[model samples]
Target: MGIFQPLNTPIRDWQGQRVWIVGASSGIGAALARALAARGAWVALSARRREALEEVASACKGETRVEPMDATRPEDFERVRERLLAAWGRLDLVVFNAGTYQPLRAAELTPAVVRGILDTNLLGVMDGVAACVPLFTRQGRGAMALVGSVAGYGGLPKATVYGPGKAALINFAETLYLDLAPVGVSVFLVSPGFVATPLTAQNDFAMPALMSPDAAAEAMLAGFARGDFEIHFPRRFTLVLKLLRFLPRRFYFALIHRLTGL
Candidate 1:
């Protein structure tokens, strides 16, 4: 790999590709399923909501299979993976995108809610990765994309528990890339700014550089085409967060306070 080159193999062609998305009921996941299917990829949609997954599949253009499963359950993911492999023979890519966000400050923190954040946002994805690693290693070629958040890049006020969960994903993805890349596996870390989805609808404060789910899906497609290790978008918003990480802690905290007014 060159110094300035992409870290993974470029996935420019989607024709006949097989993709499994763990959170495909609505928001960016649904939009991504539609986008990839339109581009001739066979998409498998997974989520707890079967009705919503069916709705998403109804709109997809190419082959789509609805595989509903709770991400936090290792057995659920294991069962679904077996079904998918039996049907498709091999999965080209799997995206762990199931997550939730709750607006909580220091005072509002509760053990149950904190556990909820940790379970869904962090543990769920980890289980999916654990379930797939052996399969991918055996296949000799596979890819995975973990959906992270810009909130993970640094701390924010309301994200209290949510922020920590996503921060863990960024680190997990980085480490997974190091281990998996040598074994013919491609790992992509997808970070997005506030996209107008049900997940972000709970926010009371004005969000910066907010884009739609469709737009977010398009950005992922572009990133996959370019073979980027970290697929973050809207660049205008995410790039600023990327730069903010370089600042000293005092300045960084002050800047966050000023930007968020929290």
Candidate 2:
């Protein structure tokens, strides 16, 4: 491991690689699946909608498996994992990208609202990682990519529940990397800036540097190829957010309020 070397093994080749994407039915997950399949990876698509998963699978150019399951269910993860292992013998990469979001303000705070976001964005992600950690550790050769957001970097308006969940996920990915890297299991944290997807369509405010889902998928693949631990983009937007993380609390808060006008 040199100063300039990549943190994880560069995944430049995808031919015959077995990959399971938990949120592969749409958005970045669907785009990634299609891209990887085009590269000849055997992709397994999983989400609550069987029909949606099938639709994405149909669009994929290479080998694909449709495994519909709920992200919030631990049993679903376990079940899917066993099925994948049985079919592929081993999983070279597993991506936990399933998430849900809702714009929330302080005035709209409620337990159900908070729990709904946390269940999919935080708790479900943790549960999925837990299911894979042991298998990856035992195999001593695997990769896990966790899809997070720039919102995790700092607070902003209308992200009361979403922000905290992603913040926790970012921390979780970092901690997972610390424990798993030495064992040959790579953990990648994907922090994307605003990307145009069904998830972001709900936002009423103007989205800066909003990229298409396909572009986001391309960025992620490029990151994996570079073996970057934290893959964030587009740089024009994410760099500013990264800088904000270093500012003093008072200044950071003030700056965010001014920029977002929230």
Candidate 3:
């Protein structure tokens, strides 16, 4: 890759594109499905909720397939990958949007909760990557998107387990890109700001720069069209987090404590 080269291929046309989106039962995942389908893309929706995925599929235009699979189960991801490959013969893009977030103080963390977050957020994405990379290698082309969070950019008061899980994803996505990009594959990391969804409904803090899921979906598509490696949105919020990443640990901790009062 050249110094000024785009990190990935810019996907300007969605018409007839085949996109498999995991965790598409609701929220940004569902919205992205609808947006892509509207643009004439064939969308395969997967989530743990069979009925919910079906409901989402009903509203999506164009050809749609629904698969219910638990993210924590690697076998489930493999099975869905096989089904989608058999059905479409080629998957242009695969987006892993499934994640969980629970606000917890450090003391409130437990073994079960820690493992649960790691399994669903970090390991789940790794498993999905493993399932898709071989097929992508065989085809010599395919794109992947991993939906991370601003929480992953730095340590926070209430993000304890959830923050670490997402932080791992940030690392994982970068590593995947290094290994996969040379094979003619594109890997994107999506770190969204506060979005009004069932997931954000769990956050008690006054969320700054919160955007709608529909808006988030739009931002994501725009990022793909631009071939951006890191598609972070609501820049008013995310840019600040990005800048804070370079802060010294002591000052960073002080600022976070002062802002969050945790």
Candidate 4:
């Protein structure tokens, strides 16, 4: 009915869908898992903390499987994949929501912080893709959703390390979409402005247009129903960020510095 009609065939029904979420221990991932399960999807939860995963899984409606694993580790991804295939036989969707973040300014830049952010945010997403691609290829149908950020749209103050990681992920998702969509697989890059979560709890400044994790989950599901490739939320904030991406480099830098006082 629109430009987005049938991007990868709208997922109108959730019943019996085998969905795996890699960062379901908390925040958006946990909320999404709960929402999908309520709609009759069998959700498999994964995270480094088994206790946290269990806590989320226990609240889910349908059969919820807990598969704890460190997203940054290749062995962990492989192990989780093997177990998922064995349990579900086939996966309908894989949401790569596992990520780490820290307020990193130029003055506070450190090698360890950069490495940790990149490993978890960028490389970790690649690991998920690597593990799931083979299975999806075999089945000839599946979907992958990556959690990027509005910060990735432009360079922001105090986002020295985190912004680059998300930027890389956004670019990676675009490339993956072009490569995988022809083969009957779907790729979605999700960008949320600021959601109230453990990850953003450390922020000192007020988060404009902050939303609850449940709201974020609802927006994601709405995006899936429309079969859109880029799932962004809180139009009041993300829309501005999207517009800024079109400004000239010099003007963009000046405006950002003036706005953020960086």
Evaluated against the true structure, the overall lDDT of model 4 is: 0.92
Give the Å shift of residue 182 in candidate 4: 0.6
Tell me the deviation in Å of residue 49 in model 1.
0.6
Write one digit per residue (lDDT tens) for candidate 4, span 1-262. 3564666656879999999999999999999999999999999999999999999989999889999999889889889888988988889999999988898779898898889889999999998899999889889999999999998999999999999899998999999988999899999999998999999998988788999999999999999998888999998899999899899999999999888777
Q: List, residue by residue over 218-260, the lDDT tens digit for candidate 2.
A: 9999999999999999999999999988999999999989988
Q: Write the per-residue lDDT of candidate 3 for residues 192-246, one digit (tens) a residue.
A: 9899999889987898898999999999999999899999999988999889879
Query: Candidate 1 lDDT, tens digit per residue, 1-262?
Result: 7898889998999999999999999999999999999999999999999999999999999799999899889999899999999999998999999998899999999999999888989999999999999999999998999999999988899999999899999999999999999998999999999999998999999998899999999999999999999999999999999999999999999999998889
Note the residue pairs that clash in candidate 3. none
Query: What stretches of model 4 exceed 4 Å from their correct place?
Result: 1-4
Alpha carbon lDDT of each predicted model: 0.94, 0.94, 0.92, 0.92
RMSD of each: 0.8, 0.7, 0.9, 1.4
Q: In candidate 2, which residue ranges exceed 4 Å CA deviation? A: none
Steric overlap count per candidate = 0, 0, 0, 0
Worst ten in a row by lDDT for model 2:
239-248
Candidate 3 lDDT (Cα, whole model)?
0.92
